[model samples]
Target: MMGKNRKQFYFGGSYVPLGLDKHVPMSEWEGGMCEMRRLGINAFRAFVSWNRIERIEGKCDFTELDYAMELAEKYVLHVVLNVGGMFNNIQGFRPPPWLSYACHCRHRIDDPLKAHIHEGADLMLCADDPVLQEKAYAFIEKAVLRYRGSPALEGWSIWNEPHGDPCYCECTLKAFRAWLQAKYGTLDALNERWGTVFPIDFPSWDDVCPSVDMSPYAHADPCMKLDFLNFLEDSFIEKFNRISALVRRFDPDHTTTFNLQGIHGHDMDRFQVTNPGISAYIEELAVNPRRVNLWLNMYLRSARTGRDGQDKIRILETDSGPRPTGKRPGCQKLASVRDWTFVAHGADMILSWIHRTRITGGHALQASMTRWDGSTPPRLETAGARGQTILRHQERLLGASPFSGRCGVLHDMKMYRYATVERWHGSFNFTTNSHDGAFMLMQDAGYAPEFMNDSMVLDGRFRRFPALILPFMPYMTRSLASALRDYVWNGGILIAEALFGVKDENMEQFWRKTPGCGLDEVFGFRCADMMYFDPVKDKILLGAGEIIPAEYFRECIEPSEGAAVLGRFPDGSPAVVSHCWGKGRTLFLAALATSRYDYENTALRTLIASFLENSGVLPLFKIRSEQNAGALGVYLATKDGKTADIAYLINYAEEPISFALFPDAGILPEKASFTDILTGKQYDDFAEITLEDRQCAVLFADRKDTAPV
Candidate 1:
C-alpha cells in the first residue's frame, strides 16, 4: 500500500522514561501499556538508550527492547523505535562506550553537560568513517534481524532531527570536499558559484575548509551554506539508508518511516540549503513512500520579541494551572489550538513530547496529560476525546485518500528563502510574513498543500493539479511564471494572491510596463503598490451581498485589474476578484479576509466554501444536529465504494449547542433512526439535535434506500 491508500491514523504517546539506568518492572510497564490501549492509542513511540543497552563495545542488550516489544504485543500497538537518542533537546538513547571506540569515534555527548563535562563526550560520529559506518550497519543489522519479525515493531526511525551544521572534524571536512569536487568539476566553478575571490582565497579541494562559525557572511552565501546543508543532510541520509537497508534485508514487509519537524524557518535554513537535498531524499522515500508524519514539538503561541524586535518567544511554556511554588505557568491556550490545527491538516500521527507527567526530573516544565497529582488533566480529557473521535473513524479516514483532484497550492521555497533574505537585509516593511498565513489558510480550506521549489513547479508535476493557489509567491523564476501562464491558458484554475509575480528570482521587480509575465494579464491586476494595515484600525464592509460579515482587516493591497469584484476594500476598492483565463478561472484576493469569526473571519470562510461549492468539488455529507453554537465540531465521513457509515459531531465549548437537521447530500432516509455510538441512544431522525459541551455524538444511520451518493 502506497500513496493515499495507505493512510494510517496513529494515536501515540511520547513514552520517555526518566532514567535509562534501570528498567521498569514488567507489571508496571504492562499496566501503562494497557491503559494507553484502553484510551484507544494504537501506536507508541519510545527510544532504547544506547548508553544503557550497550555499556561496552561489541556487546548487545535486549532487556528494554524485549520488554517494549512484549508490551506492544500485549496491547496490540505498533512501535516506532527511534535509533539514536535525543541530541537536539530530545533525549538521546545512550550507545555503549566501546561502540564509539569500535567505530573510531569518541563518547556520546547527548547527556547533560554537567554529567558529561569530565567524561569527554563526543555527540556525533563522522558519517564517512568506514569503521563507524560498518559498526553502525552491523548494530542495525543485528537489531532488526532480532526484532524484524515482531508484528509490534512496525518501523524503525533512523535518527532524531539532524541539525544544519554538524561534524566539521577532519573526516567530515574531507568528505565534504570530495562531495564538492564531484558536484563542481574544478575549484573555479565552485568559486564562481560561491562568489569567492580567485587568487586571494583559492585553495585545493583537500585544503578547502568550511568556516567553523556560521555568521551572516558565511551563512548567507547560498552556494556555500547550501552545499554544507546538503552535505549534512546527505550524511544523515547515508546513515539512514544503511540502517534502512539492514532493516529491509530482514523485514521488508514492515514500513519504515522518520519524523520531520514541520515548522517554518527553524529546521529549514535557507531554501537552497535545506530544500533541494532534503526534498530529493523525501521524494525518493515517498515514492517508496515512507509514512510522512509531522512531529509538533512546541505549541504555537504569542512569542515575545527580542530588543531588536525579532520573535524571541517562538516557543513558550504552557501553564498547568499554578505551580507548587506559585510561579511559572504552563503553555498558553492559543498554542494548543494552533498545534491541533496543524495535526488536522495532514499529520497522520500526532506524536506529543511527553505522555505522562514526570515525577522526577528533565523537562519537568513540559506539559503532559497526567499532572503531578497523578490524575488526568483537562488537556488529557480533551486529547482523549479528540483521539477517540479519530480512532472511531480511523478506517474511513485512512481509506479516504487525500484530495486527488488536479488542484495544488504553488508553494515556492525560494520565495520563503528570499523572504528570509529580506528579513535579514531589512529591505521590506512587513511585520507578519504572509507565506505562513497563506499556507495555513489553504490547508484549512482542505487543499493538498505541498512545498514546491519555484523550479519544480515547471517540471510538469504541478500540471496534474487542475487548480493552483499561489499566495504571495513573490520570487517567480521566468520558467515557472511562463508555465503558470501556459497552465492557465490550457484551462487550469489559477489563484494568485497579493504581491505575486512582482519580483523575479534575483529580487528584481518586473516593471509595470512589462507585458504578460507580470501577473497583470493573468490576474487582470497590475498591483501598483501594497499597504500594510494595523488590523485594529480598519474594518472591511462585505458590500451587503455576501453571506458573512466582514469586520476586520488582515492586510490590504491594491488591485490594478478591472476584474469583477467579489469583495471590496474598506475604502470601497476591490478586495477580492475573479477573472476568466481561457477555459479556466483565476481568483485574486487583494486583502486577506476571514469567513469564520473565531480566529479566522467569516467572509473568507464563506468565500472559500462557496468557491468549492461552485467548483463542484465539495464533499457530499450532511451534518444533521440540534447543536447551534458549537457547529464547527460536526464532521461527516463517507467511504468511496460503500454507504457513508458514520457521522460525528463534537461540541468543544463549555455549553450545549443545537443544530438544525440537514438531509444527507442525497442518501438521507425519509424518517431514519440513528444510534448514537458514544451514548448508545437511539433517536428518530428529527428536525434537529443538541449536544453538550466537550461531548461527541457518533451517529450510525442506515440509509432507507441504501444507495451511494
Candidate 2:
C-alpha cells in the first residue's frame, strides 16, 4: 500500500462526536465503528478541532480523538484525518479563545465598513500571520507525533472546502506588499505596472484595504486589486503548505490533499459566519447536483495529476442527500450512482459529509448517513453494499485509468477565482455555465472532451488530441497563449470561442489583435472589433438552414489571406471563421454560446457536424444515448486491455431512457457481445438499452479490435 503504484478505493463517512455539553461516551464511537464494519465501510474521516481538544491555552487532551482512533483500529478501518477544515460541531472552525485573544487577526469580509464583530462566529485566522502559523504548526506537530506510526492513517487533509471571507488585517497587508515585491521584483516595476507612485519598499498601497470590492478597481487601477486577489490565494496556499508540511515532518511517506468546493460553494456559500439560525454546517448542496459534481470531480482531479503520477485524491467532503428540505426518495439510490461515478471518474475515496446526525445542538435536524435515532439507514446500508460490490471489481477499476477523448477543453481555475472575487463583466463572470454548455454541445455532437488546465496543457496531455476547444476562457496569460499556439502548430486542430486570450496574465491589454497572443494570425483573422449585445437583435446566419441566433456576444472579424468564412452575421460580418495552419486547422467562433439553443440549431449543428472530419477518433466505446436531454448524461469506456468496453447510462428523469452502443466509426471488432455487468442481463439488440429513472447500467461488450495489455 505504501508503493506509488498502489490504488485504494473505499467508502466511509465523517465521525462526528455526539457529545452535547460533555465528552461523548465510548459506546457511541464503538457503535459507529461496529455499524461501519457491518456495512463494509473500511475507512472513516475524523476531524481534530483546535478549540475542542484544547479549550484552554497550553492545555491539550486527545481523549476524544484517541477513542475515535481506537474504535477505527478495532473495526479495521483506515483513517483520513482532517487536521483542520471548516465546520466543527454546531459551531464552525473557530480557534481556541486563548489564541484569538493572543492575536486578533481573524478574517474579515469585504465590507469592512460594517465593523463586523461576533464573539463566537466562524472566523478564519490570518493565514499569512507568522504567530498564528506557529500555533498551527505546533498543533499539527503534536497531532502528527501522536499518530506517527499508526498504520490506519492513510493521508492528511488540510483544506476541507477551503473558501472563506478575505483577510485584510495588518499582517495580510504587509504580506501583500512582500508578495507584490516578489512578483514584480522591485518598487519601480510595481509602480510602472500599477500606475501608482508609492514611496519605496514598505509604502502603503492604500489605506482603504484590499477587498473583494470591484468598485475600487473599476474606479481606480485594476492591477492593484487583481494583485491583491492573487496575494490572497497565495496566502491560502502558503497556509496549507505550512500545515501539511508539519504533518510530513513526522510521517514522511504519506500524501496530503486538499478537498475544494466547486465555484458556487466557494462564492455564494462561503463559510464566513457561523449563524445557526440561518443554515447548518452542511447546508449548502452544490456538490450533489449530478452534472456539476461529475464535471467538478474531473476538473479537481486534473489539478492533482502530475509527472510523478496521479495523487490518491481523497475528496473528504461532499453532500450526500436526503437534504433537510426536499422529499428526495431517490437520494439513497443516487448515493451509489454518485459513488460509482466518483470512482469511474478517478476519485479514490468517498468519505461523505457525516456518519451520525447531530442532535440536541444548533446543527440538529441535519441529514446524516445514519438517522437521528441511531438506527442503520438504507442510505448508508445500500450505498455501502454497493461499495462492497464495487470493491469486488477493484482490479477492473484500478487497471482502468486512461480516459480517451477527442477534444481537449481548457478550464481556467484562475479565471474562476478572479470572477468570484471581482465581477467586472456580467457576461464574462467565469461561471461554470460555459463549461456546462460546451460539454453538453460536444456530447450531443457525439464527442467526449477531457478538461485541460494550465498544468495539463503544460504537461502535454493534449499533444495527441486532434482538436482542442476553449470555452469562455477569457483571461489568457502570455505563457498560456504561447503554449496553445504551439499545440496548434504541432498538427492539432484548435477550436476556440470568443474572447480567448484578450488579456495578459495581469489582465493587461494584449499586444496582438483583439483575441491577442498572435491567435489572430494563426486563425487567419484579425478581430477588428467586438461587442456584447442581446442575440435577439443581431443574429448569426450560416450558409444554409435556419439562422443561428448569436447567444450573448459577437465580433466584427476580418478574414486574413487563407481563412474561410464559415458563417456570417445577418449584416454580412464574419461571425465565425476557419483557417488551416500547418498540418492542422483552426475554427474560431466570434460568438459566445451560453445556451443549448445556440449550438443545437440546425445550422450550428450542421456546422459542428462538418468539423467532425478531422476531430480525432474517440475511444472504442462510442455512445449514442437518448439520455442527452439536459447535460451530458453517459459515461463510456473500455476495460483494461479492451477485454470489454462498457457504456454507463444514467437516467436522471422520471422515466426510463435508452441509448445504443457501438465501436467508434470505421472500426470492426470481432466477436463482440453485450452484457450488463450489474444485472447479468445480456443485451441481444446492441441497438437500444433502456435504463429506468434514477437507475444506472453498465453495458459491457468484448472487443477484439485492440489487444489486451
Candidate 3:
C-alpha cells in the first residue's frame, strides 16, 4: 500500500502556518487554499509540529489538527503531515519539555547545558532508550488514530533533517562503549583500532568516556572516526524505523519518509534504507546553483533511488519566498527554474517553504506565496502556470520508468561520503564536493545515470550497467575492487577519474609488493606529483590535439598492454586514455582538471552527446519537425504498446535559433503529423522551425496514418 502507483504530475503548493501564534486565526488560510487549488496544486505537505499538538505532556489539542484536515478534504488536496518541528527547536514543532522528561534517558551523549553552545538547541532524546521509544510510539499512535480514515492524508514525514554531529552526552558514551565491547570482545581491540597505546593497565570499556578530545596518538585514529560516524547514522535509522512502525499500525496505506539535507554530512544510503520510501528536500542552492533551472536532472536520479521502484518522489519544500540575503537573482527566476525543472524530471508533488509572510514570529523573512501586504508575488503566478501544465499532462508522465539499457554509473554511498572526508587532506579535488557536475554531463549527453549501490555491485548488478563511471572515488572496498575487475574481464565500460583506488578500507595507503588494481593499474597511473592551483589560475589547459582541457594535477603513468592514449599531459604523459578490457571499453580521465561548467562547453557536450548517440542509449522521441543546434529540452514518455507522447522542445534562454529536421534523416520523429500541445500550434509540413529562447513547444503525436512532417 505504501508503494502503490500514483498518477505522476507536478503537485505544487506552498508551506502554510509560517509562524506559531494561537491567537492568529486562519483568516488568510481560505484565500491561500483557493489560490493554490486554482493554480492546480493537488497535494500539500503541511506541518503538524509535535510540540504544537501536545503543548504539555498528556494535554493534547486537536483543534488545529481538525481544522487542517477539514480544509484539506474540502479542497480535495492531499497532505503530507510533517510531524517533527522544522528548526533546531526554535520554531515549528518540537517535543514538549514534559515529554522530553518522560523520554529522557542516561544514554544521551550530548550535554543538555552545552547543547545550545553549538547549534543552539536542547538535546534530542536518544533513540536507543526504551523510554524514548515508548513515548515516540505513543505520539505517533495518537496522531495516526485521528487521521487514519481522513481522505486528506497522503503521507507522514517522520522527522526533519536529523543528520548532524553525534550527541556526546554521558548516556551515549556508555551505550557506545557497550556497543564497541560487544563487537570487539575487549577495550584493548578498540584501542588498537583507535591507535591508542595501552598503558600498564588500560581502563575497562565501562570506565571509558566518549570525549571529543582527539589528542594523544592513541585516541585519534581515522578508522575510529569513520566508525563513529557510521554508528551515529545507524542510531538515527533506528529512531526513524521506530516511528515508522508506530504510524503504519494505524494507517497502513499512508506512505512514510524523511528529508535529507542535500550535500550535508549525513550518510544518505543508510537513511534511505532505514525508511525505504524517503523523499529528499530539494533546496534551491543545493541542486540549482544558477537559480534558473529546477534541478530536474538530480530529482529524476533521486526518484529512481526509491526501494524496488515503488516510491513516489516529491519536493518536500521549494523556495517560494524571498531569496536568502536578497541576492542578485530574483525570486521569479528561481520559481520558474524550479517549476519547469520539476515538470521535466517527473516530480509527483511540489511544496514550498512559505505560503504567507510571518509578521511577528520565527524566520519572518522566509515568507510564503502572499507578501506582508497580503498580495500575491510573481512567483505564485509561475507556480500556478507550471502546476496547470503538469495537471494537463499527468497521465503520460507518471508511473513510467525513464531508464533503459544496461549501462549505469555505480553510486557507492560510502565512497561518496568518504570522498568528502578525504577533501580535508588536500590531495584531491576530483568532483569531491559534489557529484552533480559528473551526473549532469552524463544525463545531458543522453545516458541514464543509474545509482548502483555497493551491495548491488556485490550482487552482480554492477555488471548490468555495461558502463560504470567512478568519478574520483578515492577509496574502494576489497569486495568492490574484485567486482570491478570481474566486470572489466567480462567486458564492462569502466570510466575512472583522478586520485582513485589509493586508499583501502582502513583509509591507509596500499603498500603491496606487487601493484594492485587499487591505484597502480586501475587507471594505468599513480600519483607522482600533485599540486593545488589558486582559484584565479585554476584553468584547465587544453592541448593542441585534445578536445577537452587537461586538469591541474596530472598523474604520469605508462599505458598497459592494450591501452592507448587519447589525450596527454603537458609533459606528453597520457592524460585521457582508452583500454580494451574483454569486450568493453575503459576510459580513464587521469587528472582532475575541469570544472562543472566545462561539461557545458560545446566541444565536451558534443563529444559526450556523440558517444551516447553511438552507444544506443538515446531516448526515442516523436517530433513534428526536425531541429539541430541551440539549447533544446526534449522529453519522451511511453506506455504499453498502445500509446506514447513526446514533448518536443523548449528554449530556456533568451534568443531565437533555427535548426533543420529532415523526415528521412536517421533522427526523425516517429509520427507523421503531430499536434502541438503547448501552444496548440499544428504543423504538417517537413520544414525547419525557428524557436525563441525561454519558450517551450510541445507536439503530441500518434502512430495512426498521418502525413509526414
Candidate 4:
C-alpha cells in the first residue's frame, strides 16, 4: 500500500468522442490529449460506448477507444476510461440494431423513449434480462479485457448516472420474486408484512412487476409497494457488483465508480445504497462552478465517502460552465474556487465535463473546455489553473484530511426516503424537513460535519464522534437506535431533534409513546402530547424569545424523574428537554427549524449556538469577525507539511473582508500566526488576511513557530 502521506489526484476534462465521423476518427481525440498536457493537466477522461464499440453482437471494435488511449499515451496524459454506454441516442449508447429489432431490451411505461424512439434520451439495456446481460457482458469483456494492459488507465467509470433505473421486463419479475423469497423465506412472512395473500405464492411473486403508476394502489398495502421498490434497488446494486467484479478480474490497478442519483436512477431517490465493492464515485448533482451545487448535492453523494473512508470522488460529466445565461464572462474565479472547495473537502479528483463542446447532441447546455473549433475558453483556463494548484500542493492537500468537527449533523437515506413516501404519501410524517436543513445551521455556525449516513452507522463508524446532531430521523431501526444509545452511554453527546425515535424502519408508528423502541430507556422522556404546531395559528414561545416558527411536527415531552426541561413553549409545555443517559446526556429539541447559511435568522442561530455551547460541542475553528459580518463560507483543511496547518476560506460575500483566524487552542497555534499562499504576503504582524468577493485564500499556520510572520 502507498504511504499515508502519498496520494494521486486527477485533474482534467472528458475528451468527448469525435461525433459525426465514420471509421472512428482520431484527429479530434488526439488533439484533445495534446491540449490537456499543454494545460499542465496530468489526466483526462473519455466515455467509451459499449453499444458503439460493439454495434454488431459478435463483431466488435475498439477503434475509437484504442486510438484515444494511444493519443493519451503519446501526450503523457492519464486516461480515466469511462466504459458502459449511457444516455439514449447519438451521444451515447447505440443499442445494436439487432437487439432493438429483436426486442431483446425492455423499458418501463414511464420511459420517455418508450412512446417513440428518440435515440438515447435515457435508454439502457435491461441488466435483469438474461439475453441482454449475456450479450452486454460479452461486449463489456471484449471492450475492456484488452485495455487491461493500457498504461493510461487511471480509473474506470463503469457507468455514469444509472439512477433513472426502469424496465419491468420478464426477467426483472423473476429476480424480484427470488429476492422476496430469499428475504421472507416463506409466503406467510411475506403476506404478514405486506398484508397480501395469494394461493400460488411463487407464481404470484413472479408475475408482479414495477407499477407504472402507483396511484391505483392508493388503497393497497404500502409496505408491499415499498418492497418492490426495495427489490428494484437491490437488483441495480447486484448488477453494479456483477459488472465491477468482471472488470476487476482483468484490470485490478484502477478505481471503479458509478454515477450519482445515488446508486443510479431518479426513481430510487427515496431509497438508495452503494455497492461496497465499487472503488470510487463519479458523481452527479454537479454543475459548473461546483459550489453552486456543492452542499445539497454533497448530501446526495456523501454516502460515497463512507466507502473505504477515503472520499475519492470525481465529476464524470456535468455542465462545464454555469448552465445559466449563455456564456457569461468572469465566471472563472467562481469555477476555480469551487474546484478548490472540492479538493479541500478531500475529493481526489475533478473532471470539469467535456473537453470539446457539443454540436450534434441534445446537450445544448453542455459546454466544454474548448469551443467547437477547439479554441480555449475561460472555463478551461480556470480548470487548468485549478489543476495547476492541485499539482503544486498535491502532497499536503491530499495527505491531510478534513478536521473531525466537534459536532455533527447525521443523515440517513433509508429513514429520509422511507419517511417521505410514508408520511406525505402514507400519512405518517414525523418531521417537516430532512437533516439537510439542520446542516445549513451547522454550516452557518461555521462548522463542517461528518455526514453519518445509515451505512456509516451500520458499519460501526459513528462511535468515534464526540457529539452527533440527529435531525428528524423517524424511521430508525432497532439496531441503529441501540447504536445511538451506545454512543450516548459511552460518554458521547447526542442532540436529537424532533420526533426522536417515534417510528420504525417501515415507518410504522410504534404503539408506545414518543421515544419508542427502548429509546424511552435511552432518552428518559415520554411523549405527553403530539401534534403539528401551525405557525400562524398556534404559538411555541421559547422562554422569553419570540414564538418558534411553526413546524411540521412537534412532540411535547413530559420529562421523567431523571430528565429536566431546558426550555418551554408559550403554553408551558416543554420545547427543549435534556436527560442523562449513562455517562453523557441527550438534548432533544422538540421543534424543527432551519438556519440559512448566509441569511441566518437571529432566533434560530442563537438557539442552535446555545445548544452547542451547553453541550460542550462548540465549533472547532472560530472566525473572529464582527459577529457574522460577511457571507463567508469558511472551510478548513488540515496541512501536515513541514509546518503550518491550513484552513481554506472562501468569501461568498460580494465584497472582501479581513477575518482573523483563531482556531480552538489545540487545533491551531496558541499565538495564531499565518501567511496566505496565493500571495507570499506574510502575516507576521497579525493573524488575518483579506480576500476579494467570491475569492479563495489558504491560511498556513505553524504551531511550532507561533511568532507572527
In the range 544-630, model 4's lDDT, one tens digit per residue, is 565546466678777888787767766788877778889887877776644112333556656666766776776765566653443
lDDT of each: 0.49, 0.59, 0.54, 0.59
Task: Put down candidate 2 lDDT per residue, 199-258, tens digits, no spaces.
Answer: 323354454245345454444356666777666666665565556556666777765655
TM-score-superior candidate, 1 or 2: 2
Model 4 worst lDDT window (10 residues): 276-285
Residue 468 in model 1: shift from native, Å?
3.2
Candidate 3 residue lDDT tens string, 450-549: 5556676777745656576676565767888888877777666677766566677778765551124543454454454445433354433334443454
Candidate order, lDDT descending: 4, 2, 3, 1
What tens-digit string does per-residue lDDT give for candidate 1 at 1-709?
1112244566655563333423234446676777677777677666756566666776778776787788888788877666542333122444445645555563222222233343445345445556655665666666767776776775655545433336555666777888888888898887766764223245777777554333455343444654665566666555545555566667666555444333342322121110011100111111110011111211121110000111111111122222334332332332233223332222345555456555455445344555644355666665666667667755544443222322454444344446545553243322123444443444334442444444446667667565666655555667777888888788777775555566665455676532226456777666655576435655445556553332222323444445667776567776777777676667776543322133234456456546655755452333433333422333343344234345555444445667654533454434456676557776666356776644556666655456321
Query: What is the full ranking by TM-score, best candidate first?
Result: 4, 2, 3, 1
**In model 3, where is the ten-residue run with the lowest total lDDT?**
273-282
